[model samples]
Target: MSRPRVQFMRRPGRLMLSAVAAFAVVQLAGCGKQAAPDAETTATLIQPVARLDLKVAKAAPGSRSGEEIYQSVCVSCHGTGVLGAPKTGDAAAWAPRIAQGFDTLTQNAINGIRGMPPRGGGADLTDIEVQRAVAHLANTAGGNFTEPPVGQ
Candidate 1:
């Protein structure tokens, strides 16, 4: 008796069917019981990468103190003496300007000097506020300048 010979891939359709069946078996196997993520976990995974809070309280005009004004505006350049600006608390750098007197310094602050914007770049600042900031900055560098009283 002779045995029969069988070839597996003799038909292209059989090969395609075998591949589809194998894929379905794999897909079914992957459907095993798996714990679903909780709401909080899913939310965290899809949450925004960054967030900003811009709700800052602001003081009324002429009410903010000299220190407050410096910290808010003048500090940008004066704090580091950037672009020839005299750094805060540097007596030598402030000596020439201080010698020019308080009025001169106040004027310079109110009307923009080299590298320094008018009112220290604080457009909302009143003249008195500018005066106060100037006195504060000048006094910090060994000058005895007087700042206008608050709310003036």
Candidate 2:
């Protein structure tokens, strides 16, 4: 019985082509960091969409909900307790302040406490708005406080 012969051939041209292709792929698979935006581009992107003059705006009376006041202004400091401001939802941190009584708290909020600015930095916030925000913060920190109604 005769065995069939199998061909074993090497193509130098094909092997060289494969080697070049593999090298090109490895070279293209480089770990390069992306370049950051230029200063002008960064400035453009960081520019404020609208600049609000809080001072002028403060003169105009307006009613804002407690949650809105908190979100727009109080969150800046209370959210993170910046400069010793009582952090929201922190019962321990708020306990002493809450013990001061709701009226005192609202007064402090209106007059500006040790670290908290008046009206929680929202000069535009009305006295009633500040009271509501104070109630919201105090209530969240375990005090059973009632937020004042709007237009009060």
Candidate 3:
């Protein structure tokens, strides 16, 4: 007498079906409704981390003031006295340069002295603008220098 043989191929198909059903149940379980974000919470999530405020001084058309020029251009080096450049408001560091007089300082700024590039690295700055920036820098460090009039 021959015994009945169990079907091994049908067992694999049933196992695959079971696995697919389990996956679908798990995915459906996570599809439940969630609370919508409130206006303040949404805004906070998307808000900028930092902001910048540029306050430009009022000046004549196409002309920047001594302070304006200094803030924009000369502040990089002179503000911190990088590479022997005199820092703003440092009387001792500026004493020798101030002793050299306004004309000499303006010339150095225009021609580039030592580590400073021509026009304090602002090639777009005009000669008068350079003079104005020089005056602003020198004055901050206890020197009495007049800023050249704009439009010169």
Clash count in backbone of candidate 2: 0
Name the candidate that leads on TM-score.
Answer: 1
lDDT for each residue of candidate 2 in 4-76, tens digit (9 for 90 to 100): 6543334567768888999999988875787877999999999999988755343335567788788878888
Global lDDT of each model?
0.91, 0.83, 0.87
Q: What local lDDT does model 1 show for residue 33?
A: 85
* Clash pairs for candidate 2: none
Local lDDT at 80 for model 3: 82
lDDT of 3 at 128: 86
Compare the candidates by lDDT and give the number of the best one. 1
- How close to the true structure is residue 19 of candidate 2, measured as C-alpha lDDT? 87
RMSD vs true structure, all candidates: 7.2, 10.4, 9.9
lDDT of 3 by residue, 41-142 (tens): 899889889979899765554399889888888899988879988889999989999999999999999999999999999878888888898888899889
Worst 10 residues of 1 by lDDT: 3-12
Model 1: lDDT of residue 42: 95
* Candidates arranged by lDDT, highest first: 1, 3, 2
